[model samples]
Target: MGIITAGKYEGQHPIHPKARQILLDAFDQGWADPTQISSQGRQAQALLDQARESIAKSLGLKVDEIELWGEPELISPIAIWGAPGFGVSPFIYGATERSEIIGMRGKSKQFFEISVDIDGAIDLELLTQTLQPNSIVAIQSANIETGVIQNIKAIAKAVVAQNAHLHIDATASGARFVKPSYWSTLHFDARSWNGPSGVGVFALKNGARWSNPLPHTRPTRAPNSFSIPLALAAASALEHWIADEAANSTRLKSLIERVRNHVKQTISDVDIAGNAESTLPNIISLSFLNVSSEQLVAELEIEGFSVASGSACVASALEPSHVLKAMGLLTHGNMRINLNHDVQDGEITKLLALLPGIISKLREN
Candidate 1:
């Protein structure tokens, strides 16, 4: 199939021969709410347990620390706003995240944005200055569009000194550079890890407290309706994918190296974002001197290559990526290339060979 634009299966489906049967078996047992504990629920619960255990083992965490949720956004809000007994807090970071944070603006008195350096990393000095009692600091482990990795270890320490909590959105960092154990220790009261677009895992460190951020009658904390099949698939994908990552990351790093070297050598005035050594191996964000990112993405797609401008999650929006803008870089001409394993080396070499010509041709237009 075409290069996967989705999760761990990026460029290829992660459904190995054995895993495919497991997934189908999960579906065959079919739609039963895992929470019910009936006969059907028992079957569903078994699947859920297997999924939870698999995901936990992959990340080096115990099963109970991980909680399943249907909504990806629910984890963040719940972690930030849930009652202490349930692991919620009133702390809010000054900088922004997504729809959930925006929705809470009117409800929070403690909201604040942490400043970033020119490279889009949180200014450690500024972050240090912002700490307060009972605060919860929200920071993404890696900036989505720029691939800028945050020093969560440092940030966590700073949060602790202030007697506060740390909430890391590891959507982009999970199964990449930050291992599951790193997250278990680094994440303070709560942290949200995105396993796939549809499945979200919110981990509450054993004793962290939170307040309920959202309203519901039963206080049903889980989101995304708890699908047994999707959870099983997601867990299966993560376990197998993590096992495959060491080799894959090495391969992906080589591909990105080619891009970095090719661009530096052939494309004058192109700005590559992030700390090259620390950036995510699979992603590179580059901006040509005078070209629009939209035009470049369209041109490349017409040439039978798929790439994204900024984060894939926000590509459809017209606004310049919050990530690039925050870094004080031009948002107009940025293109983020996220490499997938299915992408052949020949394709990357061809694209690299063709890029200079494409840029020159686009420049003339």
Candidate 2:
């Protein structure tokens, strides 16, 4: 049986052929520590620097503004809560934000949630009213579960107007959309764009008021080191994705719309989440009445299709999705489909044809 799951967890994609080859070729050089001054180390350092500069160029940032980190989790706290002169400030985030930003609630001096519209887009008006001077605002470029893209440029303007710092989680938007130039701070994971996992990029615009959140004796900004090969592969993947973005988005949007329209027409008591016109082209979320998401996922997997429910990043948890709940949508019987760049038209067609019957059977059971 062929596996055809539309919604992938963590924006996982098959590594580009070129990126895979680069990774393999760098295995020997990647093993050397770049911090050392030896010949082998210097070679590894050159490769690492090249990767850093390439990634920075892709994101429209200077090399010095970005740092390679082990994971987004390692850098998020520092970016959010660590303002240079401010001890701790009020934290504000959208209600539909990922669990990572939500986890920053009590870590700040004060926490507030900006409401989202029914389509899962943040209420910019409310955000404008909520901002205070010296506040730290955390926003995502796109929602992972709902595929709702935020108007981060506008949001950033508001944050900057209030003399606040903006921390953007662009992990879900890495290859799907271009980075907004107004971002004060940005975060991304390599796995989001068909790059290897275990690597993340944290970028801070020059003159952004930020200090180290972690306790350390050393004055180094980046607290940890990642594999050089992984960084190079990530850079290659991102560059490839950027080059092919326009064509891939058009194709994926067509496929997603086909599935969305088919599901709406064929399934009863089903609701499609997110605003398609302003969302990531490759992701679609649908909820069916009286169906258990876990059971549906299991049944689909048995039929050689893998799907996800709730927050893909925290799929292991049994609780209802905070994102759907915050959007005032039903959380049960939900499924998310993420199409990678290589997903075939046939695969999408098959999934569309199978979904209606599967929903009916599950409801009956």
Candidate number achieving the greatest lDDT relative to the actual structure:
2
Find the 10 residues in a row with the least total lDDT in model 2: 4-13
Model 2 vs. true fold: TM: 0.93
Cα lDDT tens digits, model 2, 1-365, are 65544454443556778898999998854466778788988887787888889998887789999998876566676677665433366788889877777887867667889998888888999999989986778898898788888888789888878887788888887755566656677888887877888788888898887777778798766776677888889999888877776567789899989988898788889878986788888788888888988788887888777777874333676677888999888888888888777777988887777888889888999
Show where candidate 2 strays beyond 4 Å.
Answer: 6-11, 84-87, 311-315
TM-score of each model, paired residue for residue: 0.85, 0.93
What is the lDDT for 328 in model 1?
72
Q: What lDDT tens digits, residue by residue, belong to model 1 across residues 1-365?
A: 24423322132223444455666887887757777768989877877788888877776666777776665556666676653422234455535354454455456655667767666667888788767766667777775566777777777778777767666776666655353222222221101122334566777666665434566667544444755676776687676666666557788788888889989999988878876776887777887877766677777777777666763333676566666676777677677776654557777887788788888887888
- Candidate 2, RMSD to the unseen true structure: 2.2
